[model samples]
Target chain A: MTISQAGSYPSSKGIKISTVDTKEVLCGTALIKRGFAHMQKHGVIMDVTNVEQAQIAEDAGAVAVMVLDKLPYDVRHAGGVARTASVKVIQSILDSVSIPIMAKCRIGHSSEASILEEIGVDMVDESEVLSPADENRHIWKWNYTTPFVNGAKNLGEALRRIEEGAAMIRTKGEPGTGDVSQAVAHIRMVNNEIKKIKGIYDNNDDQELIRISREIQSSFEIVKETGKLGRLPVVNFAAGGISTPADAALLMKLGCDGIFVGSGIFKAEDPLERAKAVVIATTYFDDPKTVLEAQKMIDEKKSMLGLDTKNLDLKMQERGPTI
Target chain B: MNNELLIGVLGLQGDIEENIKATTNALKEMNLKGKVLSVRYPEEIMKIDGLIIPGGESTVMGLLIAIKNGLLDAITKILQEGLPVMGTCAGMIVLAKKSYDKIVGNKRQLLLGVLDIEVERNSFGRQYDSFESKLNISGIGNDYKGIFIRAPTVISVGPQVEILSKFDEKIVAVKQENIIGTSFHPELSGDYRMHRLFIQLVTNWKDANKGHQNF
Candidate 1:
């Protein structure tokens, strides 16, 4: 909430301002977005975008949780479109927690966001790429008040999103897998391309989005070589293959605002316990005291969704969630 | 007694302060007196001259609003009272009489749906999908630098609603009597003219209210 002359708070990557009079509570590392209420006053952001996991994350000190479009167990089983399966799962997560819930719409699923609006999730992340028609065809971020935190592979893509209106940025982890290479590439790209812009993107330019993405793609090699996140286009967070607190900590060292633990928690041995531990790792990335304390709290509880819920379940996933 | 005029900012979610800054600055420029306050309490609706709903994530705000003190009922009352409300981006969605689909529709979509329009959330795309344009506002005269970030698009407008601006034939701005809705961020552009126009609405309301009070 500390706005400068431009009416925005400065971030390592971009401006962090709030519409609510409520301050960002960043004096020390309080988290935000994944069931934010329980966050242990660490400014280190801990954003849990998955709903079933959000409940556990919220209980375990997540500053905020994101309510994303979940890959339905049924849809995964039946092999259909990533159909909206656990719509109510997200709603239940939102209903249960006071922290922000980030609702995601896959690339080109703008209509899906409308349902999220009705469901009342907090933020959004358009994670998946559009179908060839949308991605190859290209679709831009629309205007929204929910400060959007987008994923970029490099500085240019980050800038493109910022230039187009992204308030925050994260390195795009080549989704649907645990590949950290894409995440690494994104960091390199952002660090290399940091010096190229002044203001965030606020226009609808096709060339700009692609150009930025290219920069991000190119810098992946450089970032890997340097082993550092150079300069993010906005407040940078890391995603893709982050499962453990130690993994979360490594990305933070690599320069991320937070880490999006996608399949990490829900797929963990103990979701609730690991959710707490991840929250600790995200905010206390640099602080050993907090990290150790969070580690002690880890109680390895079996994650609810079994192997049957794992990917390649086209039928069960298509069957959708009864919840 | 002179009825005090007030402006309400949809404190539901998002940038309530930005609108407060612009609106307060513009009102000051117009030689008018008002207060910019955070409206977690819906009862504040009764004391304002007008309402300004700032831009932010509408989904979060719409969902969280019910839990924020007594804001829900206050918004419902203000709209029913015919209080002038202006919405920008996410604010526009909150002000619409209907929207594409929302999260908690069963408990009733927490929309104060007062305006005669259907607003689609994130219609413009994601943050990376965002774009800016030189929007030619109908009544505001000058082409304001429109800042649309994760903005919405008006899918359908009620007959009473007037389409104010468009980009590539997409409806981005609209107006209906006292309610002014747009898909872009005007305050972000440092333009006080729109605030002035809204103030004019407040002033006119003051004048009309004065006449009614006397009678």
Candidate 2:
């Protein structure tokens, strides 16, 4: 029977398929959430704490704003439990900006995710930058209708998140460092792993593919899909240590679909100009001349004093599961 | 064999890729040859036979159009020149003569003012209130899934505008001249009927305007 004629069939918990056209099922399908995430491609998602900051981000051309209780660097320095932002703050940010607003919940904090979803936040980031509420489990994201983004340092970690129903993935770079080294390293590692998997898929090594899937703890279908695509099934953005326009452009050049600025924007000496510059750089990432022009938009000394990732006492990137 | 049509999706912001994919799929299903490109620069808009404005943040999109050098003027000129354009969700908001967000108070956004209609942004309440329902578009067949996510609703239409579809008795889709606006997202609905309709509109326009100096 055709998909349209097949009648209704039980699928995933939230999703329902009419079996009529298997490819055309609409309601809670991965396509809808992925399509939402794809909307933010080649754009910047800035972290904003208040209505004013959200306004600044929108004016500076941020495609979306991440509602945070404190900047990532501040979270790192405070050394306390960094949970999700209060409903009040999120509501204010939502009211202040017409652009999409994303909020961060502590890893494994599904309650916080539900709250944000209830309040109508566009997306939620199960961010590692926030203190982990549960070490053994990340949010079981498929249970919610709102799309989610999670961080990963390698292909296996990325696949695991996708398996958990993450609609978007970003490198869990050492956030708030201002040094892009960790972000770069994570992105390269994931890309290299994808290349290796592609090689296995090209050889039609089903057993090896199964072995890899078992090792990664991700489903075989998703792992094989990743191998075939030579990349994560979802949009891969670079997050964490992005500070300067040059840094943002560098990540885009390294094949990230987008960049997320956390402590980078508001912590800089000139946030307004810095934010605009980073956006311009991201948009014209392939043009060296335009990147240079964007680079000139801000002063080096005025940028947030970047921390050396190697010297950091805590590495948020290492917080998430490896396999 | 230079008879290929180029369709452009406004790439300034929003759900651009999905629209591109949907349009491409629509073209393929129709057995038509067409190239889909994301239009960022103003000059790029001049080369397309048709245009699509995908859903996103209407206020931000308007700000970008206002700031982008010559983009607003370019779009206005093209619309006046009878370029076939489809605006979905926030895109529909951008094409309206007037738009208001009740939650944001009395402030009205600067829009293309090309389509003579008034739009209420986020008329469907919050994001959680978003839902999908089968719609019977005037031209397209019934049971076309229409996805509404923080969608706008057309409150009023001008004499020239033709209402295509409605949900809950609210105007959700319309057409005026070469422009079409839908408060729901066709790209996300996994149905390419609306996109197919737009493609057909583009092809017809191309045929009628063949060899015309200003396309």
Which predicted model would earn the best lDDT? Answer: 2
Kindly report the docking quality category of candidate 1: incorrect
Chain B fold agreement for model 1, TM-score: 0.87
Model 2 TM-score (2 dp): 0.90
Candidate 2: give the clashing pairs: A3-A19, A3-A20, A3-A21, A4-A20, A4-A21
DockQ of 1: 0.02
Off by over 4 Å in 2: A1-29, A321-323, B106-110, B211-215
True contacts kept of 1: 0.00
Best by TM-score: 2
For model 2, residues B74-192, the per-residue Cα lDDT tens digits are 88888888989999998998899998774664443568999999998778665545566678789897778877777789999999999999877789999998899999888877678
| Candidate 1 TM-score to native | 0.48
